[model samples]
Structures are given as structure tokens and as C-alpha cells.
Target: MSPPKTYLITGTTSGMGLALVKHLLSQSQNVIATGRDIVSRFPREIVAAHEENLRLLELDITADVDTLQEIAREAWGLFPGGVDVLFNNAGMSAVKACEEASEEYIQQIYTVNLFGPMRLTTAFLPLLRQKTTTTTASSTVIAFTSSSAAWTPLPFMAHYASSKAALSAYLESLAKEVNPPPFRISVVGFECGGCVTNLGQPRQHKQQQQPQSGGSGGLLAKQQEEKTVYGDGLGKLVGMFTRDAMAYMPGDADKMARAMVGVIERVGKQGGGKVPVRLVLGSDAWESVKQKVEETQQVLEEWKEVSWGTDREGVRGGAEGDYLRAVSIL
Candidate 1:
């Protein structure tokens, strides 16, 4: 067993976030769980039983940066020893065709999925950095629940996937900026596969109090019916999901949470050494990424000449050339 570490997780009202909170508490780790209406969202009995190890705060990640900074400051105060892990796990999605997706809705998704996490991480950086200089200093990690949907092609998930892709890219750039020897912070993105979570439900379905899984079918159908042009294609897509919605996202949330903890523990145990930039959580996610990589490699191979031809004829030994050569891009 590793030493008990403090974890601050966003979006703990339900699904993977809630499961992570419970699993960490079970392991005797301190958890600061945040979400909107957490008192109603989390089981009261569990909260009472783990009062010493758990703290709940109401947070809507879409809030302004100043508000997020305030909450981050408050969270830092809750655990003065400093956080060992900051889990940016809160996310939301809407199920609608790109053509029909409103600008407001699109902006909302970006705010929640991309901008919110970025701002929150900025807010907590000082706190995370504080842990490194303390007498009881230890490795600190910034973890994200980036989705495999970032690279996979799933209809009506374009905006969600785009947001996650941006998040992943941002995290990659952040890892480069931090994680050097003295900084002692590690950034990891989990390209999580589908699990039986409420994420698939469109916002409207949640408003109507429908089942989380398979709830998007009716909404998707209604949208397509009005368009008519997308009728046949949407019908097949809806039919597939209606027949086996679970097939698309079959991983158990509890199990996924456990695996995530295991990974975090391993990274922490490394004593702030190098860790993977991203980890694929489930078999479905692994396969999706694998396929995407292979196809990309094939494309690159086919376009190798054209890609390399774009460079200037006289360009050879400059800084950019040297760096590209070092990485074998030349």
C-alpha cells in the first residue's frame, strides 16, 4: 500500500468522478470532491461515514476564471499539506448534428470541456507547486479525463470530441512546459473509453429525467426527422445505438476508477520521475487509438514526398532542420 495522498477531483456528483471519490476514500486517502448540488448528488451515508477523509464543494466548472481561482484557493485551504493529485474529471456533452448545433451550445461545450479545465489548472498550479517545496514534499500530478472520442469518429459527438482533442493537445504542451526535474509535476491525460455513465445523455434528456444510457436516441431521431436530409443515416446510427447502446460503452465505472487510481499511484510512487503523457483506459479506447495511429501512419507514408517537399530548397542545417533531423523527421 502506498502512502495516503490527498486528491482533489471535479465532477464527483456521479459516474467515474463519484466512483473515484469512493475508491480513494476506501483506501484511506483524503478526497476533496467538487460538483454542483453534491449534497444531493452524493450518497449522504457515504459522506457521513467518510467525513474525515472527504470534503464536498459545489462547483460548476463553466464558471469564470476568477470564480475558479476562488474555489481553487478554498480547496487548497481544505488541505494545507497540499494536493498530491488534481483530477480534472468534470465534462459534459450534447448529442446533435454539427449543422444543427447552436453557437451558444458549441461555446458551452468548449467552456466546460476545454477552457474550464485549463483555467482551473492555472488556478491550482501555485498550490500544486507548493507541495514540491514543503518539508513533506512529494510528487504532484495533474490528471485529465480526456476521451478516446477525441480521435474516434462518432456521429453527433463532433463538438465533444473536438473539445477533448484540444484538451489533450493542451495537456501535451503543458507536460512539456512542466515536469522538468525541479518542477516535479507530472501531467497525464487518460483517453478513456466509454463506460456506463451519464455522459452519453444529451442535456435535454437529463432535463426530462430519462435514463442516462440510450436516452440520446429519441432526441437524435427528432432532430433528424425535422431535417429529413439526414434521415436514413441518422436512422442507421440510432438503430445501432438502440439495439446495443451498452456495446459502445461497456466498461464498468467502478472498475475504470480503480484502474485510474492504480495508474496514479504508480506515477506518484515513481518519486516524480517520468510518466506517460497519456494512458488509454479500456480495451475499446486502446483499439480505437491503435486503428487511428495505423491509418495515420499509412497516410503519412503515402504523402511522405509531398510533406517533405514543402520545405525550402536551401533549408538544411538550421535549428528547425536540426531538431527535425534529431527526431528523425528528415
Candidate 2:
């Protein structure tokens, strides 16, 4: 049999992260699982029994830029064969009115969801390049756990949705540019639905530096502009997310983990064949994706004449087709 693949996954403490790690280990695969605290997440018995196949490390995704790079390097050293997949799975959730959330809190959520994950991905590229150079097998994967909220931005979870949406957009473009004609490196956005996880519960939010009352047209101005549009606010969302509601969310964390692992396994099976840029999991998420597509199509159709109106003579649709034919990504 071929050598077991090495996986470096973040946020392995609870919810989807923990579940995925558990599933990987059950197959006797080598896993480098990271959390803010190792002992809190992994059982002592499991760690002891699987010590040879497992490596536990403390990695805070929201740490300073240098700290993230340091831990990533350390993680690389932990697996000499090189990382087959980098699962950017760590994230936190805050439930508050969008304006009520301080600028610092918004920055924090984006750090964990977007910037930090990108840093880790870039840090590991050299190692991934080394793997592809040596093996010439399927491309190395960088799969991030984006949310369906990205496609359908909610009122209460505006910041979270924005962060996830931006993350997905970045990965979509990055996947195309990671390497040119000679190589194919897969970048996947594993868009998970509402899984039963600690993500729904509130975490400590860092205090925003600006005084709540005094801020003039900077952050407050942006907040006011948004509030004007979302004036209806999140009353219904708040009511829907009672404690029991959170506990009764439709997504099962374990099942979601298995689904993610299945994506990785299928990609590996390809041995460098085509892998999808995005996989929208869960029935709710699938429906949400469909809704977005339908609505986008409707809007495009309504504006098609206006859209074409801006175009010069004969090159309306042909321009885009010509560009794609030049690149040939399709």
C-alpha cells in the first residue's frame, strides 16, 4: 500500500474540527492536529495509543502574523514527508448587532477566518511545491471551511458572513493562480452549513479601541449606512437562535467531518485529476447555494440589456469567450 497521507488541520478542539481529526485517526492516517490547547481537545487514552501516528500542537489562528508562520513551520517539521492537505478549519462566532460589534471584534473575526488562514496557506506552499516536485501525483490541497452564510448574508451575522464570503472569493482566485500550466494545485472551499458546534455560542470579544459614543464618520458612518438598509434588524434571527435552537441545529458535526474527509479522499483518488473549486455540503447549504444562483441569474437576466448596453459593438459576449479561450481554464 502507498504511504499514509499527512494532514495538518487547525481548530481540532471541538465541533467539525474535532470530528474530522477523529475520523482521520480511525483510518490510522498521520495527523498533525492543532488547537489553542492540545490536552483540552484530545483524549489522553487516544493520544497515548496513537502517539506514533499523531502530533499535537498548540496553534492560535488569531495570533500575530509571525506567530502563525512560526507554528506552521513547526507543524511542517512535525511531518517530514510534507503535508498532503492543509485544513483551515478554526473559527469563532459572535452573536451581536452588526453596529454593536466594535471594529476590533470585526477585525478579530476576519483575522481568524481570512487573513490568518491565507498566511498559513502561503507559508506551506514551498513545502507543498516540494511534495509535487518529488511525487508528481495529485496536487496538494488547501481546503478551508467557508460557510453558506457567505452566499446568503444574514443580518445578525453580518461580520461572520462577510469574513467567510471574502475567504471564499480569495480562494477561488488563488486556486487558479497557485501554479501555471505545468502544475495543478487544488484549493477547495468546503462550504459547511450550520453544524452543531461551539461556533454558535458566544465567545469573548476583544474590546474595540474607539469609544462607542464618540466615533464620528469613520466606522460609525459605515455602520449608519448599513443600518439604514438593514433597519429591520435581526429580531427574527435572535428569536430563532434560542439555546434549544442551537442545540437542535440540523447539521451533525461528525457527519460533516466524514463528508469533508470524503472530499479529500476523492481528490487523492484523482491523483492530479480535476477537483471542484467549491463543495457546498448539507441540504440546507445546497438549497441556499441554489437560491443564490437563481437570484443572481434573475438579476443578470433583468439587467442583461443594460449589461450589454455598456458593451461596444460586436464584442459583447465574445470578449469574455475570447479571454477564456486564450486561458483555456474551462
* CA shift of 291, model 1, Å: 0.8
lDDT tens readout by residue for model 1, 192-307: 87776666444433233211211122333333435645566667777776677677666778888898887777775646454677777778888999999999999999998888
Per-residue accuracy of model 2 over 31-73 as CA lDDT, tens digit each: 9988765666456777887988899988767677678777777
The CA root-mean-square deviation of candidate 1, after full C-alpha superposition on the true structure, stands at 3.8
**TM-score for each of the candidates:** 0.88, 0.83
Backbone clashes per model, in order?
Answer: 0, 1
Model 2 misplaced stretches (Cα beyond 4 Å): 137-139, 179-181, 202-232, 243-248, 268-273, 312-318, 322-330
**CA displacement after TM-score superposition, residue 180 of candidate 1 (Å):** 0.6
